[model samples]
Target: MTEQNRLKQIIEAALLAAGKPLSLDEMIGLFAESEQPEKKRLREVLAELTEDYDGRGIEVTEVGSGFRIQVRAEFSPWVSKLWVERPPKYSRALLETLALIAYRQPITRGEIEDIRGVSVSTNIIKTLTEREWVRVVGHRDVPGKPALYATTKEFLDYFNLKSLNELPTLAEIRDLDSINRELELQDPDKVSDEQPDGDAKAAEGGEEDPETQQDGDDAIPTDEIDTESTVKESEAEAEPEVFAESSDETDSFDHLDSAETPSAEDDTSDQQIDVDTEPMDDAEQPETEPPAVALSDEEQTPLKTEIDE
Candidate 1:
């Protein structure tokens, strides 16, 4: 076979046997320094091998770390049966924390807490670190200098992502309200199905048929009816006391009204008296004599004699 064909076969065999992503440097290191193929030629061969696997059960793909041959996700159901062990199940909280770290790299734990609106559990961080999905990149240059975290290559490979840029945009990540609205729009039937029949009837504002109503009444237990009747009787017996209390309140309010009525009448009488006196005083003022009376001759003579003295 030609050298180009042989190179493709060799690369394919190495990827298959490695069972994990192999970096270009690792693949090139396989050959002697002098005999090593050019990086460009290796890439061309890798590309050819990827094309050859197209439409096949497996495919050659590049992840954040490097290249690997993995079974296509479409065939995973059938292929997964070959393994006796079950795949691990991750909690929603863990997945959310991981996504945040992946998208917002170099994020501090406090920052993640702020976004999630809860404290990050130590166990969650421990679990992700143990799984090799995340690692502490560095410390923030602030008070306490919290450690910053970033997604590792294993995280990308597991999610089938080539890089952080492959992640969904912030706009694409729907908020809880938008997600709930979308769910409501997508499958209204599902939401309806979850509701009880009585609630659905209430929502529709429809009355139950006579037969259904009779059936529901018949389904009530005898003891429940007795209890309900007893409650009604107790309420009826206590109603006289309630009415008596209310009557007492009414009597007190009537007393208050009676007490206030006299004062109001007194105020009206005072106002009326002032009004009557005002007109009488104006009318009498014109009839009353002036204080300046004409001086008698004897009084004038005494005043003149006093002035002369």
Candidate 2:
């Protein structure tokens, strides 16, 4: 077999013999031999080996600062069904705390607590210890010294990380914060109050345009007002006045058309003509008297009394 393939077989043998995940650093010493394989060469070989397993059931994954070989998660249920084994579940919060410590090893619990913003309960520390995920790496030399913790090989194996560097980037961490904040916004009740007032004020500050504000300032000369609102205002004002004038003229023409016109004669002449055209009086002609029949003396007496004769 070629040297790289030989190295791959050696690494695989080591993993199989070890029966667990191994750190690149730990694997480094083993790869160190009479040949004295360079770190770069080992990494390339490991990469080539990892790629070989891509389509296969086994995989090489990095967690914390190390690497391990394991079956892919998709096949877990089938493999688990055969073995009657289900892996232990780590609550996301607990995993976050563990990952922080794993990547930032020799980290104090206070710092972890600060990151978590809650007191670290004893059970959390104990569970990690029992699971062999974390170990008491060392203690700080500072005052009132606190114990420092670091992730173990088990953490690497569990997470399938090749090395601490292979752990997700710090940028990814910041993105996680953003994503979490967004999730918090998904809850309707806390959205308004949860956002910091200072952050909001800062956002409002960045968005403020001083020039725009200055444009709105009252100190501007009257010339500016005449310049800005003048055109629109003039158009608005002139249109209605023009419409009104046109309407007035139209109405005046209509009134003139519908007016009661005088006759061709002058007003005085018309009045004289009106007097000349009067009807002849009913009493001026004998024909006005109705033809009468003879009446009895009593009727004639009543009629003579009504006529005052």
- Best candidate per lDDT, number? 1
Please provide TM-scores, in order, for all candidate models, with all chains considered together: 0.57, 0.43
lDDT of 2 at 20: 59
lDDT value, candidate 2, whole model: 0.73
Tens-place lDDT digits, model 2, residues 50-82: 888989998876565456677789997777777
> lDDT tens string, model 1, 1-309?
998898888888999899889989989998888889988998999898888889999998999889999999999999999999999998777877887787668899988887777788999999999999999999999999899999899988888889888976544555533333422333455456657876877868666454544454458665788999999999999999999999999999999998877887799998999988775646566676769879999899999999999
Error of 1 at 211 (Å): 32
Best by TM-score: 1
Cα distance off (Å), candidate 2, residue 92: 6.3
lDDT for model 1, please. Answer: 0.83
Q: How far does residue 105 in candidate 1 sit from its true spot (Å)?
A: 1.5
